[model samples]
Target: MAQSGRTNSVSISHRSTLFVIPKWYNSATFPKDIMRDNISRREGLLMHNKMLFVRPDKPITSVKNNSIRYSGWTYVGSANLSESAWGRLVLDRATTKPKLNCRNWECGVVIPIRHNDEEKSSYIPSTRGITTSVAESGGGNTSAGSDDGSRVASVFEPTVPVPMKVPAQRYHGRDRPFFYMED
Candidate 1:
């Protein structure tokens, strides 16, 4: 966990592996120098300028009065991590020719964690679980807890904190992404 003033950064390490997220470039909530150690040498930086949603585990009641266990999900937007979102070249086996296939609209996908036997076959198991901690501004003490006071472990391993709030707020009526206009 990285600590500076009232800001808290979560780092999950097990065995010899460490996952660290440096401070975002233009964040209003967490300023620069939020990380405890210098991370300029890190291989990758999360440069997406979009919304992130995080939801820890929770319980819900079903229509049949049964308790439903909610795990979590990971969403990848088209603009950020989809090869089809940009463009991909493929060889047409039937036609014996090469062609380019492109997705013309914005899209995203939400992958849910395995929660039952039916999902066991389809869902992949994650090797690492998520652990979070918030430290005091100056005390530098770290503990494990999230907004729900529970540790969120995904069926998909190696979870990292997104550069946004947990359980992101829904967009209001007027909220929309910017689009190009020819005017």
Candidate 2:
């Protein structure tokens, strides 16, 4: 999780960026009070156009929910926004190049942004798949998580498609910062 004070540390709006959050995560594990507090702090910076925050029109968990459609790409997976899950930065002495050390067996489906008719796209499974003209293999477990050749898939995928929501609505508070929600 990003620190609230760290919210003032960078300027990504100059490049046009936004952060999207779910309307409600499972409160049994993540409480509502904590969500409100973090949103409150970040809202101040977002209000000035430093960046944007969005919530979905329907609870992302509901299939019948009114989903917002976006023109850009999307990432669907169980990974968090942390360095460890994304991959830790490592300096390679031999090549003198920075590399992302991916030690865990993590996988995801990345949908690329298609802006025009000339653009072509495909979704490939990271575990095993055919090599295509547009495919690029990234980091993965070197040993396949024990040489048994058979392993169970991780059961930790998020219940809701967390990244599919678009900016919709936010409650207007005169003295408080506003967060975005998808309608």
Candidate 3:
């Protein structure tokens, strides 16, 4: 397929992206999204061209130094490491095994924010420019509890106690079971 005008391009308009970076690059503080005109088509097939960039304008400035895709990444089985090794964990809620209880390997969903692993931000900060911490957010407890410096509270939250009324006309007699229902 002879393609023209297919140069790597990115613009900050109305769009979402999931910028996956490796641990090594993540340490150096690189923004997940390519913040410059560095989209290079290192390889790919047909109309599906692969993009390569570490701030592509500055390949030397990668937040993660290793490969992002799963095929090239190492496969540590769902054992040995009880806690997930950062991005090494793929979360699955249905897993009975504790080791594999990390972030789920979701398919084709866009992320809301691009995290710069080297720096941190506060949630509605008094001032927005403080690089304070990395990934230490709770689900915002609506109920009070003793903070024993434990993660048991974050692992699960108490279900909202408010009475949720099921709209009668919403289902309309179609007996399609809920998503979790199984035959």
Candidate 4:
């Protein structure tokens, strides 16, 4: 599929709906023009089809009958639709998600990466930054809690030490402050 040497042609039939995915494509393997042509063949065309979910969105499962006419739900996952037919990689009865360009939270958030009107993302950032957690608050060098659940500080680290004791006032019946506000 190298651009230097590639033929833009493939056979298709009106029989079964083509479940297109990258089978064999790589930098050294598929050149620019060739990759473009191949992608144009399926991915590009499918992308233009509004009825189909483009990008990483994939079916979760397939329930096939005991016949050759059709099968079950053809579930898809994070394998990224490589140009290879790895139906075996499809994990049955497994907990998974259709690979997303962003995360679950970032899903549907729109982004303006291009000048054209067509180049708009379906998702938008809910906040000013991509700070997932306090640890990720500082440019990622500051990691979240450790595997053992130890704390990791961020730019907004506590200014005062926790469990600070307020000045105690003498009272008739209290030596320690009442833990509950109701009393």
TM-score of each: 0.28, 0.28, 0.15, 0.14
Query: What's the lDDT of the predicted structure labeled candidate 1?
Result: 0.33
Q: Model 1 clash pairs?
A: 126-155, 126-157
Question: What C-alpha RMSD separates each model from the true structure?
Answer: 15.5, 20.3, 21.3, 29.8
lDDT of each candidate versus the true structure: 0.33, 0.30, 0.22, 0.21
Per-candidate count of clashing residue pairs (backbone under 3 Å): 2, 9, 10, 24
In candidate 2, what are the lDDT values of residues 15-134, reduced to their tens digit? 112233345342355333212212222343432212112221111232354343222334455665455567788898889899878866556665432222221132112222222111
* Candidate 2 TM-score to native: 0.28
Off by over 4 Å in 1: 1-53, 57-67, 81-104, 114-141, 144-154, 157-183
Candidate 2: worst-modelled 10 consecutive residues by lDDT: 147-156
Kindly list the per-residue Cα lDDT of model 4 for residues 149-180, writing each as its tens digit.
01111111232121101111111221111121
Candidate 4: global Cα-lDDT? 0.21
Off by over 4 Å in 4: 1-26, 31-47, 50-64, 71-183
Better of 3 and 4 by lDDT: 3
Better of 2 and 3 by TM-score: 2
> Which one wins by lDDT: 1 or 2?
1
* Candidate 3 Cα misplacement greater than 4 A, ranges: 1-38, 42-98, 107-183
lDDT tens digits by residue: candidate 1, 103-150: 666677665443444543443222124212111111222234323211
